[model samples]
Target chain A: MIERTATIASTVGLHARPASIFAEAAGAIDAEVTIARAGDPVDEAVDADSMLALMSLGVEHGEVVVLRTGDDTAGEALDALVTILETNHDA
Target chain B: MHSFVGVGVFRGRVIGPVRHMPPALAEPPVGERLEGSTAPETAAAALKSAGATVKELLQERASRAEGAGKEVLEATALMATDPMLIKAAIKLVNTGTSAERAIWEAGEAVADTLKGLGGYMAERSHDVLDVRSRIVAVLRGVPAPEIPDFAEPFILVAEDLAPADTATLDPSKVIALVTAGGGPQSHTAIIARNLGLPAVVAAAGVTGIADGTQVFVDGATGVVSTDPGAAEHAAVAEWQEKASLLSVFDGSGRLADGTLIPLLANVGGAKDAQEAAAANAQGVGLLRTEFCFLGNSTEPGHADQVAAYKGVFDAFPGKKVVVRTLDAGADKPLPFLTDATEPNPALGVRGYRTDLTTPGVLARQLAAIADAAASSSAEVWVMAPMVSTAAEAADFAALCTAAGLRVPGVMVEVPSAALTARHILDHVEFASLGTNDLTQYAMAADRQLGPLAALNDPWQPAVLALVQATVEGAVSQVKHSASLETTSPKPVGVCGEAAADPALAVVLAGLGVSTLSMTQRALPAVAAVLRTVTLPQARALADRAVAAASAAEARELVRAGLPALAELGL
Candidate 1:
């Protein structure tokens, strides 16, 4: 599995437009992607492809979150989602 | 004809066939477990297909919307197709719940989570509920919910209408609206009046009126008379003809004797300013500043306030723009500014009272208004809300002037200020009567209480007496401030729902009010009715209304006094 940590860059966090954008990106990749707030228990991890799950995480700007994927092409999927979560979509 | 009465939102008469709104869809049935293992798979497919249909529907709506409406619809669309919601629903179905029930439960679960987050995230619960309803309809093989459109004019009958339901309504096709539910202050009522549609809100048996039944709606009297005969039809036609004739008398309101009454618009922000301008509002009477304070955890900085105020001021260059400072208090408790747990926040610390305790907020806001005024050509006037004493009025005026604002005024919404209007007016240059709150305070009725609606009528004798006192005080005080040769009464305006009423506008004028500010849609009718009477007749009506024993009696007396207005605006 490939794992990476990224700071939420959207001023409004992973909700509204940013949540939709991140979820869409993750949904497009062929992988079982999961996300959780940094230091959260493994059971707290939610499917990255689900807009509701991403938004329910209540990730705010500058907050750190972890993304993990079991697929071989995890690098491409993580890069796309990390780029989405790291950019201020609202701005 | 059978008649039903409720509160009228505007003055006008409309004759049209009834068109009832479709009822809200039922909730998914509970406890219907999946029949077999394959039931989960079938439910998953249903969920996906339903989500696609909803997404498509929202996409179509978003494409047609503009500005904020477009943003809201697009955001809702994204929620409709959220993969997490679908996966959650599928999981619930796998747990032996019916597909429809699973979708409903999963949507509620996520919505509850968002609601618990509070603030902006909590607001997203509405979007989640809206998306869930759409998906549930698809699963049930029912058509998606929408406000119906017609090829011809019809009276819209509904239990109640949400903002989205009414936003896209075709004004030309909807002649008038009669709702079985909703009060005078409901958003549906406000929008109907804003759109110039005669509306009767809280009319019992509104939904019971047969479809396509011809009805005569008198928005002035809040009377919906069904199955009208020839005589009623003729009266309606005559009123309509007169209304069309008076449509030519637009612009500044005036008395039959040519007394000028500046009709200004009460606007919320830039968008409302634009609408007011389009409706030929002479100036903005009440530019509410609440929009700036809403949705902010901390008080907005002077620059943010300046930018927002400038947007409104720029819309009405060279026109009078009276802006009220943050009216926040008990009801709209700002976490950063107010005590959320304060008992009786309305009566305790609100309006100007809050500002006195929390000086920084008021000071910054005044500075912002001053900046906005310097940058725009509109004649900016600043006012304080909930001023109960002459000293408070003087302090607010001094603070406003210190910040470089020229026209300083105070809102006469409290009984003490209204009772001693001359004393209060002596401290400020202008006074705007907020009749809604004045009625509330005078009658000791909570404006939010539906059962106490009778005491909250602007036509209540006590309420009218207070208004009369304020107007007379303004006239005397303005004359007191000016030279002996300049005998014009100090400019007193009515900026409330009462000012929008044609009959009440005349009474206000009779009581010496100089300007009238209301929603733009009510301006034309008010202007039309004002022209039908001389200054003396208006005073007579005011005297009659104020002398009546009760609100109902006062209204009846005024209606009897101005019988011509029944068909004059038509």
Candidate 2:
């Protein structure tokens, strides 16, 4: 398990286009990934492929979310996903 | 058949064989069903197969158009993958139906879905229409139909036009369009105006006319004459020539006696700001800040807000940009404003009212506007919406002034504000009548309810009475303050649907509206109307409009008062 904190750079946070883009990128990696807000239980596992599920979490800007990935390319996947989340996509 | 009329949106005459858009494309070939297969199972399999074929066809088209028509193809691909349509098909199929039947049923179900989603669905519908058209063409095993050629320019009649149908139409060859369905703000109406084609929408029986029939569309009168006599044809030709002449003047707006009125554009975002500048709008009259709040989950920070304001300010260079702070509430619900509960949202705690309930939100927004204005040469005037009382106006003005923002104004939208305009003007630096809301409030009618639409008419005497009061208050303020050396006259402007109406523009200008702020597309036409009448003539038109019993009568009275101006072709 690896832990990292990143601010939501997308203007609209985890919703609609941004969430869809992040979910698509997360699904491409061969890893069992989970994301949660700080202090929230890890049991609330969200499939990174579902935009609706990601948006249901209501993750907002500057809120820290924990990302745990268990796979050979977990580090690469986590880095790429975090980078995408921290940048505006709708533009 | 009973006849109904609508304002013509495009111009051209088409006489040709009628070609109705073919129904849903034939379903993809399905594998033979096993004997005694359950209806549900067979339906599911067939639907799955149909979906796969649609997906495959879209992918192939996209790949083929990758370099030359990538944007168009990509939009079609989105339609092909629309979850709503796919879900509707699945639901229908699961209830037991052939794939072809299910697809057709789904298409019918989603046809009205676009109407409920506003701008987002309007855009999506364009793509869906494209996909449907392509599928129909494929099913027919024919190339996409060529633009229909007419021996002479004739009217193009249709039941209703999807945006895609209008997209491929050639404006030059199309003289006029008449439709049985569509409203003033419908996609077809907007597209017709953009193409400079005369059109009349919601004219019943327009599509029922056989092909090669002679039709005369009078856009201004919203009348369609089928198989018109020679006299009518000659009159329409003369009107068309006048309309062509009116299209020439577009630079600055001036009244008949040469009184200059600044014609500005109302923009909602950065893209709109750019378009306004490109279209020669003197400046942005109303830059709505609600969009930034409505689309995001959290309040935009000072830096974020400032950046957005700066973008618009920079775009106009040296021109004035009036930015209205977040008017979100009831009518436009922001996701982050969870506590903004109202039984009647339109008349609820919104505009400046929200500022009192949500601490720091308005302050932060004001700070951002101030900071942005400080960096730009363009003047930034900040305003608030939904203000009904003098106290609210004073409070907002004081807050903005304390934050070092210049020109804090209040939108005179509520009837109370217009009725007591004198009190409100004493506190704010300027005022802009949001006529749409004021009309709704004055007439005690819900503007959105189609049934009460007649009562909610902006031209109603009651509505214009409130507008007159607001203007009188502004005039009184100017009179009282004109003698004071420290303060300049506070100019009153209008930013609403009424401001864009060419006929109403004359009335508003006559009623002492110093500025007219409207959509970019409407500026040129409104400016032309302004140039045709002097200030006194405009005032007389407004007076007559206020005395008229109905919108139609008011319009006619104003038209009769300005014969030369009418010839300018509004």
Winning model by lDDT: 1
What is the clash count of model 1?
4
DockQ for every model, please.
0.59, 0.15
Give the best candidate by TM-score. 1
lDDT of 2 by residue, B373-426 (tens): 999888889899889899999999889998998689999899899888877888
Model 1 Cα interface RMS deviation (Å)? 2.5
lDDT (Cα, tens digit) per residue for candidate 1, span A1-91? 8988899998767877788778878878888899999999978899987777777888888999999988767797798788888898877
TM-score of model number 2: 0.70
DockQ of 2: 0.15
